[model samples]
Target: MASRFVDTHRDISYTKDVVRLHSHAFYELLYCCSGNLQYLLGVDRYQLRRGDVVIIPPGISHRPLFLEQLAEPYERYVLWFSQEFLDQVQVFCSDLDFRGGYRLLRTAGTPWESLGNLFAQGCREAERGAPGWQGHVCGNTMQLLVELHRACGKGEMPAPMVEQHELLDDLVQYVEVHLAEKITLEDTARRFLVSQSTISQTFRQKMGISFYRFVTQRRLIAAKTEILAGRQLETLYETVGFSDYSTFYRAFRREYGISPSQYRKLQQTQTIPPEA
Candidate 1:
């Protein structure tokens, strides 16, 4: 019942090279249908492969790293939701051990498999706008939570994700708190009391990408949010900390498969003007 007259597609393909990361103000769920990814969570890093489901809460910064030399493309079905969408279920299972915290749903067990299927079906139904598709998706989301709880209760919990390098946690926090400011690997490394090499190496190992790449990826994600929120690119680019137009254009085009100007052109709607 909560359809934005303009619903963005949940399926996405990421093939170009990108180095930015992003966090939402609302909850988002990602199911990796194929390929591998390394995700940066709050103070931790996770190496996610096929069959792994990642849940990113509002304000949690995350980045997707490049695939290995022998790896394939990274494609996934993602569902985005606001807090109000799932609050109704809180009353039904407040006492569950995994109640309020986010989790990574594995593809190994029966429960996770069910959740995957339900998610796939819900996306299909939502796209089709079947008789009660919105409600169906909302319902499937609740069921997925239930299955997650059952899996946790039965003691099939995956290890609590930990950043590969302990200091990488502090680094992520620093970058976000300073998202709009000028940031560089050397400056951050000095501030954190670590050598540039250590900082670069540790960040890459812990976050599955280099420090510079992570910052860029975060900026790109910020740009997308600004586009969705209907902001002008000239201001948004600076707001997200890009140094120059050429770099921003290259990063935006590479990350999203289209130039920023083109993206604005495609999303042009009279209701909200994306350009200043």
Candidate 2:
């Protein structure tokens, strides 16, 4: 079995507000210790209350909006770990859908206290870095997952997650996979059986970007990866779904503030130093 060595834990108290649109390649669990914040996940905006737990899957775009002026810092504990770690825990609790997007586990009853303790323990173990700390952290994470499963089973998790979130997630993935193809908004809407307006609205609300801009930026990102890998710029445009060089050049420049050629030359120069 492949092993994963990535684990992160942070108990942060943000004095300033936060706003950004991004995604991760690992699972994230946020324990709201004390703070009222707005969390945007997919097309849904949630008012996160104290004692609320938010679970986010990999590659799902989400952002947290903090209060501009706060009497106290927005406090929360964030834990991020590889899916492999979640898989190991899932072996013991197989009914849970770990890959599901945006699971909200409300803190209530005994489970709430138990989860808080688990998060606290995990944070401590991670920070202490004592002998066998990794094992202790994993143990705490496993217990936390188990508790969340129990809460979901009892329907205490609520309907914070819905099919629309899952659908939007699938839509994003589909676009990524079909990036090289001449996939249009209409094509996506037709493929997913959703109206163009709904798709546009979801992108705006969740990603804070329009569908066209999102696709163009994603293509530029993909192109940058290939260019850094020494792929020729000649075919990079078509390979990454751009219809023409002029269009690709404009989009790349607009997104990166640098033309593709300039970007590639910069990457090459960084890798190859001048002769002494």
Instruction: Output the number of the TM-score-best candidate.
Output: 1
**Angstrom error at residue 259, model 2:** 14
Question: Candidate 2, TM-score vs. the true structure?
Answer: 0.60
Give the TM-scores of the predictions, in the order they appear: 0.61, 0.60
Candidate 1 segments whose C-alpha is farther than 4 A from its true place: 1-14, 17-19, 67-70, 94-99, 109-111, 160-163, 166-170, 173-187, 191-276
lDDT for 204 in candidate 2 is 72
Model 2 scores worst on lDDT over the 10 consecutive residues at: 267-276
lDDT of 2 by residue, 1-276 (tens): 011533546554564544444455456788888776667664456767677788887655566654554455667787776666767766887786767567676674544556877888888888899999988877877877788777767865455443334565677677678889997889899998999999999877555668887777667656766776688887789999999989888877776577778876754444211100
- Per-residue lDDT of 35-109 in model 1, one digit per residue for the tens? 766666654667676667777665466656554421677767676665555566777877533325566767655
